[model samples]
Target chain A: MKSTWMMRAFALASLFMAGSAWAEVVVKIGFAGPLSGPIAHLGKDEEYGARLALEDANAAGLTLGGEKVRFELVAEDDQADPRTATTVAQRLVDLGVRGVVGHVTSGAAIPASRIYDQAGIPHVTPSATSPKLTQQGYRTSFRVIANDLQQGTAMARYAADTLKLRKVAIIDDRTAYGQGLADAFAEAGRKLGIEVVGREFTNDKATDFMAILTRVKARQPEALFYGGMDPQGGPLLRQMRQLGMNTQFLGGDGACTAEMLKLAGPALKEGAYCTQSGLPKTKMPGGEAFFARFKKRFNMDVQLYAPYSYDATNALIQAIKTAGSADPARYLPALQTIRFNGITGPIAFDERGDVREGGVTLFRFENGAWVAVP
Target chain B: MDILLQQIVNGLVVGSVYALIALGYTMVYGILGLINFAHGEVLMIGALTALQTLGVLERIAPDLGPLAQLAIALGVAVPVCMTLGFLMERLAYRRLRNAPRLAPLITAIGVSFLLQTVAMILWGRNYHTFPQLIPTTPLEPVSGVFITPVQITIVVVSALMMAGLLVLVNRTRLGRAMRATAENHRVASLMGVDVNAIIGATFVIGAGLAAVAGVMFASNYGIAHYAMGFLPGLKAFTAAVLGGIGNLGGAMLGGIVLGLVESLGAGYIEHLSFGFLNSSYQDIFAFIILGLVLIFRPTGLLGERVSDRA
Candidate 1:
């Protein structure tokens, strides 16, 4: 009787095998960001974007090399620190992830990109905008967002041409990202013949700016451009208003977020401008739909780089499909030339791995919300 | 001239907060001869606790006056920090008192990291927006120079607290006992000083002062985070050492001097360096002064206790 039962089980196994012959492939994509620091909110937002992308791709029944592929996200926290970023990048490479989407800060992304390049793994950063990241000629490094060069020029042109502000003062947090952006803005401002009145610097950890602000106030510039994230930018705005500077405030994408609004509180003045490195949410290919879906899934507003992350994840997946394999060796070439319309905009990389035809959208704080400037 | 005056005002306002925080360091060091590295974490706890309390109060009693909310917040922060200080003394520092000096110093650092981690878990790693209680209007007593009402309040409140602390440490029997213990622990114990209690009380009082300073710091900065205490704590320690590590008045003097140097250096760094250096080099002033004091005058400016002993 036992032999007869075994015979029946063998028959059932044979029937199941005959019905389906394809083996499923799991493609692992690594995500690295500061999941546990002052900017953890932005990091987590990037994580959620990658997670949602994988979920949607899996739901769509993606196939690679004629095998049903299920995309998986391997998330790691770099603490928004440069040293930690290199260590985590090595860990992700050791885990044999096909690709990585992350590194929310320029300081971390630059170092981590070298590690990925050495390991021959493709890394796409959703946020970090320092121009030096791509200038290093690391074939493995790619950026989905516009570099600070594009952003600074756009901001400078808008200030000089639209608002016609001539005299400007600049402040930076003296970080790789902040200094690089501030330098670019200053260069552009000078080229446009705008009189640069003063330049000052502060570290990222500083909470006080009275000494620097006082000196800047003495110049009485028509506008003030700050190159730093929201944590510093918001307080600077508050102090500037308190000191009655009444000058226009502008910054790059680092200061362009709903979190900045909250940080600035009532200090957020009307017509305070920021440049985001993509089309406004309403103007993206599927931006409005993506925003609604993201809000529903996460129960929180997108802080800043979530949509860029979503595009980055999709771009990686598209490259894998274009190569018809999940191996980094096979897909590295495909990634260089892949093009797809993303939630942020068209996704295509230049020779240096920067987004091609990258766009910047200007935003103004009005009535307690960031409204897109036409 | 106006810039110099403005910078001095900025320096003094910032220096006072440093002075308050430095007092705790000086007192603890005076009694125990140990640099309480975790004193900074205590300040962080005070600020974060106050922020959390204010958040809850604002939600439950939105109609409550801002001043009342601030009072309640401080009321919660002070005791909580005091208890934490007491526990730190009793549980961690007390056991290691008889051990090698390095052991307690390392333990203090460990305790500091532990508190920071716990705070991160409880309050989150993001910067919480500190509620504005006082008006933020800048009062320009002189043209081209600005000082806010909040800054004025910080200066006034810290001055009052310093005066109160002076009375507490110099005008009471408990104060006499504390002074005796600090002078010589063994002899003071033999003289019925309750050396252990005096040491414990110093920690509690320091924590209480830190709570007030923490509130003022968060108010002045308009934001608070788990890591907020670190820089201020280090600066305050520098102030303590500059004034003479165990001298209360010395801490105040050191803090003010450090603040002035930092402000003036940042304000004129370009002119000072022929456009090579900039205000970004502001934090370097503290370390430079700290090194100068340690090398040139180990006894500090007004350091009487240690100089007498040495």
Candidate 2:
């Protein structure tokens, strides 16, 4: 009787070990952005988007190498500073993340891209729009949003052709993203025969723009183009109005946010326009369902770039599934040529790791909400 | 010419706030002989406190007039900041009073960071749109020169507060005691004056000024955040030094001059640099002036002889 009981115990232990061997594998993916600064809201938005995607993927019971896999997101705060971004990237690499989903600002993304490339970890930026981010020729660097060159060109053309403006002034906040977009806009504006009236620059942290506006007022431009985030853009518009400068205001994706409406208040009621780097939500393939599901899960409205971040995360998962491996080296090749119908639109990368079908959308402030302009 | 006039108006409006903050730095340095680096953080706390108070008032008493709401917010912020100022000196600076001069300065910086971190925890890292209690609609005092009612209030309130501070310092018994304590701590104590109490009073008074400056700043800019006080604080410190670190009149003078220079510099920097540079160089003017002053006339514009300090 004792020998039979011992034999049964040994048999049960082996069966349990076999069951454990077939359990799900956990894969870590890194997300880095300014999680604790002025732009923390935007970073948190991107993070939630990635989290939703991972949760969905887990619910779908993904399998890799014939074993169930679970995706874990490791988020880091880069503070939107370039020096900190490189350190965060190394930390993620050290933590054994197979892929990364951010380094949100272009200033942060460009520097961090070098570290990811060196470590052989493929990273995709959901929002960083500076052309230099992808132009560095890093195989590991990919961006889902349209670059500054494309968005800037679209805004300049809209101003010149649609608005029928002959003269425009430009101002930038002297940040990597802001200055790059302004430069692209200026180049495009000159090519379209629009007379550039004034060019001014301010730091990102400054709130006062009375002096700049005073000078711009003297130039008497028909419209003004601002290349900066909404924090500065909103105040600039308010100050412009206070100075009695009734000029049309235009901005790139940075200034085209719901937060801008609150910041600019009554000032935005007249002649404000912006361009976003993707198609409007109504125009996207799976936008409605994604938004509804997101609201249900997060209990908050999607700010901006959340959809792109969701698509980026899904692309990484798809690439991992296609390669049938969790290793970075194995899935990188799959990621290079991965194609899918994302919520934002078709998701495919060209040789430079830029989305093949990047679209720009124009928006105007109507009834205190951003309305897409056809 | 009209642009120049408008820039001047902008400069004066901004300058008055700087002067208000500068008074805090000057008075503290006057009595303690320590540069309170955390003075700026005090301004931030003041603004945030007012913002919090306003939020509560809006919920509890929504029918209050804007001016009354503002007055109540200022009342709460002033006392809170005063208490903070008193605690800072008693808890942190008092222990390091006899240590090397650098000790108190470093401790002040540490205090500043601590306050900022605590604020970040309380308020989170988002910029709050400070409600403009004062109307922001511009009134053209002169043709092509626009000034808002908020701007006028900032200037008028600052001048009145400065005048009140002057009378308190020059015409009150407390002021005499403060002057004695600043002259010699031990001698002031020997003369039966409560040296500690006088020093504490000085801090409280200065903090009150900073609270007002904080509200004015947020009202003018229409936004407030955890890090908002840092730049203005540094600029105010420069203003104090430009006028002479411990001199009251000098701080006011330095603030207006610095503000005018900055505004005019930003307005015409492109032309001044012959198009090679632009208004982004606006921050360079303050530091450049500080450097020039330190090298040429360290006594500052209104500063007396160094021998008269003690």
Candidate 3:
């Protein structure tokens, strides 16, 4: 019986090899993220991440059912819009991709994930942090970034315990991402015994923030948290200085840009705090090497989420390697077991696709640049 | 009292810009009875011209004084706007001289899009920050609220320009010709009033006013981009319509009203239980107001019936 089983295994192995030679067995991976628009820097970094990881895996060869295979990356540009995200997701499905590592913005990821779920494709989002993403309870869905709930609490802890602030005002751009972060910060501040003095709303396109700042000024808040991108935040900082309400500013990663100095003008003085997912570049394990190569390749400061994108891509590619198949059905469970060290930090994801050891960085706007706060 | 005072100062600063652009819209509409949709794009070009001129000046004389920089910006802006205004009339609207009313308006839109595309290619989509033209530090903070010198400069300069425009339109002999041309182009041409020259003059003034507003906008904001004119243009159009589309005084009034409404809207919105109408919807508020005025008061607050001769 044992000899018969050994003969059967040998026969199966030869058959697989013959099939591989004839079929040129390949598993395609789909990566959808923002690749263009005002917030495009992060998306480009993400695409590069997928490319690096897949390239490495393809170099070593994918072992599926103990047969050699190749990996293909199918990248789609969502332009950071939700409607575009759904169309891209559907296109990837029609192409019969195995899995996906994508979705930069929560607004886009939430709607796009539904398409992936229906198609039975597991997708891991490296950056979408809105809590409602996991609340949907889709089996094929997962998020790798620290959610708003965690980030909001952490920011609040920093403000209350670290900064020792008393009263604070918060404003949101009224979009999904901006409002989500705002609500989280507000809730955390209240929980941490900080007086939530005032809250205001503005559009993402606005340049004049005098009215909002003036209103917040009346309340005399010690700090103002602006939940928006650098485009709006920069001008707000400048106007705040010009308006003579020289209060401290707290913001999320959206405000983490060198351009903010130009936007806010001379008022981008020292002590403005910004929080972002993952360790600072100088803190990441393989950050310096990635930065060196990226700077050499891109000829610019890897300006946004290049590090996170790099790691997210490597993690997805590794899962394909261990599973040795392109079938997401075969590799997704294996993907959940990812325990790899990434450029951003240690890469691990829960069954829901959220990162297990999600990290964040804190920095301050000082002397015309974002100086990482120790 | 202090909050209200601070809000008023904020309103006046932005209102000055709204009024300047509105004056341009009103002047063109008053003379030609044609809404120049491309006025905003012309404004953007004027701004880019100013930016380029300042850049050259900065390169040539890095330590140039503020007066010299302002002079160079104006020098570049004036001629560019004049040439742009001349070409727009000759190329785009001239063909539609005898077409239906909608024809010239559609041409204006095409011209607007064309200019926007050109701007995107020339300037790229990213916002470019210009060097600070005005001192930005606030003068003082009284009762924890204050206004900047730039705000005062904006209000004062806009007021002076408006006052000069009023004198030019009402008191000058050239103003009489313009009024005659606007009243009846065919009759005025037959009467030897030089209707075409008056029309060209109107373009030059409107284009020039738009340039001034563009310069002020870039100076205060520290940046300019291709789409910078869009929101400001919409608000200024609203200002023109609200004050009475063809009435010069009405445009100024409309601008101040819109600015106040925008500033007060945020305050009132925050006071609302749910903030259903926050600052995010400020532009929408202006549009809504425009729609309501068109629906109920088509002639607007100070508009005169065309049948009633001035």
TM-score for candidate 2, residues paired by index: 0.94
In angstroms and one decimal each, the interface RMSD of every candidate reads 1.3, 1.0, 2.1
Considering summed lDDT, which 10 consecutive residues are worst modelled in model 3 chain A? A34-43
List, for all models, the DockQ compared with the true complex: 0.60, 0.67, 0.39
Show where candidate 2 strays beyond 4 Å.
Answer: A1-24, B304-310
Tens digit of per-residue lDDT, candidate 2, span A192-255: 9888899988988888899999999999999999999988888899899888888999999989
Writing each residue's lDDT as its tens digit, candidate 2 over B1-310 gives 8999999999998889889999999988887888999999999999999999999999999999999999999999999999999999999998887888899999999999998888899998878888999988898658679999999999999999989988888899999998888788899999999988998898889988998999999987888889888989998999998988888998899899888888998998888889877788987876788789878888888876344553
Please tell me how candidate 1 rates in CAPRI terms. Answer: medium
Clashing pairs in 2: none
- Higher-TM-score candidate of 1 and 3: 1
Candidate 2 scores an iRMS of: 1.0
- Comparing 1 and 3 on lDDT, the stronger one: 1
Higher DockQ: candidate 1 or 2?
A: 2
What lDDT score belongs to each candidate, Candidate 1 first? Answer: 0.89, 0.90, 0.80
Best by DockQ: 2
List residue ranges in candidate 1 displaced over 4 A. A1-25, A63-68, B305-310
How would the candidate models be sorted by TM-score, starting from the highest?
A: 2, 1, 3
Candidate 3 clashing pairs? A63-A324, A64-A324, A142-A352, A142-A353, A143-A353, A143-A354, A144-A355, A234-A264, A278-A359
